[model samples]
Target: MKSYKDLSKEELLQLQAALEAEYEDAKSKGLNLDMSRGKPAASQFDMEMDIMDVLNSSSDYKTAAGMDCRNYGLVDGIPEAKKLMADMMGVANADNVIVCGNASLSIMYDTISRSMTHGVLGSTPWCKLGKVKFLCPAPGYDRHFSVTEHFGIEMITVPMTPQGPDMDIVEKLVSEDEAVKGIWCVPKYSNPQGYSYSEETVKRFAALKPAAKDFRIFWDNAYVVHHLYEEKQDHILDILAECEKAGNPHIVYEFCSTSKVSFAGAGIAAIASSKENLDDMRKSMTMQTIGYDKINQLRHVRYFKDFDGIEAHMKKHAQIIRPKFEAVLKVLECELSGLEIAQWTEPKGGYFISFEALNGCAKKIVAKCKEAGVVLTGAGATFPYGKDPGDSNIRLAPTFPTPEELRAATDLFVLCVKLVSVEMLLAQQA
Candidate 1:
């Protein structure tokens, strides 16, 4: 198959005409499909229907330590749950973890909120400082940027490499700028790109000597166990241990949640860090409430006993979601493979496939799809402040849609891509 870039002018015109006709025929189907948001499909959630039965009228309420989960005593979490989360996060012990609410995003928000008002570990509150900056890896999670933006923190966009964020730039910026207080990292199976950070990148993050004593790496390891193929799973070095080895024990605050593993809103979330970091966070948490919901934590531990059990459960998830991912990848590969107009990541895990179209074409493609009854993650959603500098990145979330719907939606997506790219090329030609 010839690459689109190698096509003659007449050939390009002929290809454009054929693709436009296909686009029109696809539009006539009146298909209403959505490939927006990395939500688990209803079928995936249905597999865990038994989770609701795990804790019911006839359930036992005592935790492994014999603490009554009905009471509000364990502010951090029950021992078993802490151990479960710790092991899942690849930490050495449960002592380094604090199990929190259902969503890690809330824990993340509160962490930033506390640091803004009260400071971290006795340092000056960020709000009191002249400028508070956070290093944001571009083509990254928008929610991470939204958290910092909500707090009025300046976000510096760092270019991302396939291995991870550009470490040389990270090391330099962190070491030189006192205002650079934090970095947002989705080290394993990163949100949209599904690229795990290499060991060297993790080591560099661990050894970073930030000018700000209160600086921290907000490590959101949301997809640590989310693999589409069990045989080809990617593993990342434990950042907490690496930081300790680098003599920077307080360098990172890692977070994880069973949002994808279980129900989105009802899953248990946890934060892992050094003893000192955990202690500092507890001071603020103590004033916030008596404790998080231990009942739900107990339910999770009872249902998924340990790391192995969790892995086994995730395999069931893989069974359901893997096909949807393949469905979209198949369409992209078959329809757009030789079209030099677009490039996309073939991620082994996580829920998103990052697509890069010709410069200034993503917004047009998304708009075109929306007009034909397909919804996509907004064109620039993968960047900070919702602005893709090149306006080329589009996040394809294949998880929530059914396979048939995914196929129909991706088919439209390809049509739109070809239509828009041809228009751009013709405009240049004229």
Candidate 2:
């Protein structure tokens, strides 16, 4: 397992020939596997089939507070659902939480849209401003970048560490630029890398004095409870609470959902922020709809009951997907460890693994994998505007594939990586 960079030209060419042969054989298998998105497998869904039975035709439609869920009211969400969501977000007060429809992404999109049209807490609408910008931590969630990019917001790339995004840069850009409106964060078990924000990073975030009063931290804690190992979980300070302690209560808007916990398309989502922020959002929300689906909120409350129930259910999810993560890690370690051609994250809780390949090799590797019947997320999808500056980072989503399918797909993936690395080294030699 010589490092690809150290291989002699003759050795590289020989390795290239062998890897090309392997890739050709893999192509002949006629396999089709998709690892593009972090979606739960059917087996995880099959295990929780009882949630449908939690509510039935004869079940009472009234909330514990005696409000009929079938009617149009509780524009934010039901009380029980609020408490459940608040507890999940580590917020003591349910007043800060507003549970929405099945996806947190929608809440994020609407928030950005609302700011664009109206403004944040009566500041000038973003559309009225000359320039609006957002800080995006690279190898972050693509959808988050998409939402901001769609609004014509400029995105600044921030390098990510195991602890979180580089805070010094975050602090500098936020303080110096009035146009820096917000930053996208997946604080706990972040997308792709599975990195959690450090306590110091969260405090630094809370303590920032942004030039823009409208600056907000879009904290998408999408995997707060998604842990692969019970003993090896990551936690961080509650951003809302930290902001309150730092006297910046309105500086962060946190969000979460049960999209992965229960059903992907049908689960409760929420946004937690200061009362002032909530009030401002409510003004716009009141006009958006008479109310959201209250019966569905009631259904979630009845099914999960509380944070404890959600925790227990997520443990079951860990039991299923944990092995898939380990399988991908094992292959990466066994095949690519000493090759010095790649590096990958070993996440404890999240749905993805971030792989860093040799410079200028990511796109070629992805194209090679797709040619062999294994489709991956586009090479630069992790960065803003679908551009990875080095063209070296690739996101690996192992949750959707079965254990056997994962092995085959990963096997092809490594074969492509090796073939690409060999070619890259041979070219460098010439």
Candidate 3:
């Protein structure tokens, strides 16, 4: 296979003609496949149908601590659910963990809202401050940026390496800027790239001497227990434990949810941090509402039983989604390999595979796929402000569709990539 860069104008024109014909034939199939979000398939949902039966009209509604889950008293959460979430997040104990509403995004949004109205701990409120900024690692979660941007906080783009965010830039920016209030991190099996922070990256995060006392690492361990390969799992240094060791105990607010593990919107979410940080958040939480849905929390506790049970359940999910991932990868390797015009991350875990097309090729590729009856996440969605400066990265979600659907979608995707790459190269040639 010749690299697309090495092809002559005539060869490029010939290849483009062939790929465009494939695209047209694909469009005629009336396919309406979507590879946008990392949504679990309907077939996978059938395996967890028994979760509904875990609780019934006659079942015991009381937790292990003797509190009736049917009631609304436990504002934080029942002990067992906390234990499960804590264990899943790799934290030491359930003491500092708070099980909240179904979405971790809600918890995340509220965390920022609290900082806006009232300061973190004793620091001045972000709303009262002159300027607030955040270090955003590129090819990062879009929602994380949405949260910060919603608060009108300035976002600084931090480059992401295979290990983690560029820490040299992170350390300098954090230590010098008092208004650099926070940094968003997925730590384990990160969104899109599934790249876990190395031990050193975690240590540097823990050891940072931020100029602002309110600065925190929004460590979203959303995929801590989400591993695709049992033998080749990614390990991250526990930020909570490491922060304590570094005397920066209040430097992180870790979040996790069973959104992917169990139900998406109906899942239980949680946040873990130091006692002081938890206490401060609890003070604000007390005023937010009477209490969260403990009944649903109880359902999760009863369904999974323990972290080990949750791990076993995820393995079943992996079995269902892994082939879809492999199908996309196989097509990429077959069609795009040695093209010298693209690169991508092949993660062992997490729900997405991140691909990088040639400069200015991402939007064209996504538009091309959509025009052919396939929908994909917008090209720049993985970066801050929904703008990938190079217009190169595209997030491929292989979890939502069946193997056949995925194969068809990948076929279209690669066809689009080839067509777009040739056009891009031709534009450069002219």
| Candidates 2 and 3 compared by TM-score, better number | 2
Could you tell which candidate, 2 or 3, scores higher by lDDT?
2
| Candidate 2 runs further than 4 Å off | none
lDDT of each: 0.92, 0.94, 0.91
Question: Which numbered prediction scores highest in lDDT against the true structure?
Answer: 2
Give per-residue lDDT, candidate 3, residue 340: 90
**Clashes per candidate (backbone, < 3 Å):** 0, 0, 0
Candidate 2 lDDT over 1-430, as tens digits, reads: 7788888888888888888888889999999999999999999999999999988999999998899999988999999999999998899899899988889999999999999999999999999999999999998999999999999999999999998999999999999999999999999888999999999999999999999999999999999989999999898898998999999999999999989999999988999999999999999999999988888888888988888999999999999999999999999999999999999999999999999999999999999999889999999999999999999999999999999999999999999889888888887877
Ranking by lDDT: 2, 1, 3
RMSD of 2: 0.7
Tens digit of per-residue lDDT, candidate 1, span 296-402: 99899888988999999999999998888888888889888877888888898998999999999999999999989999999887788898999999999998887
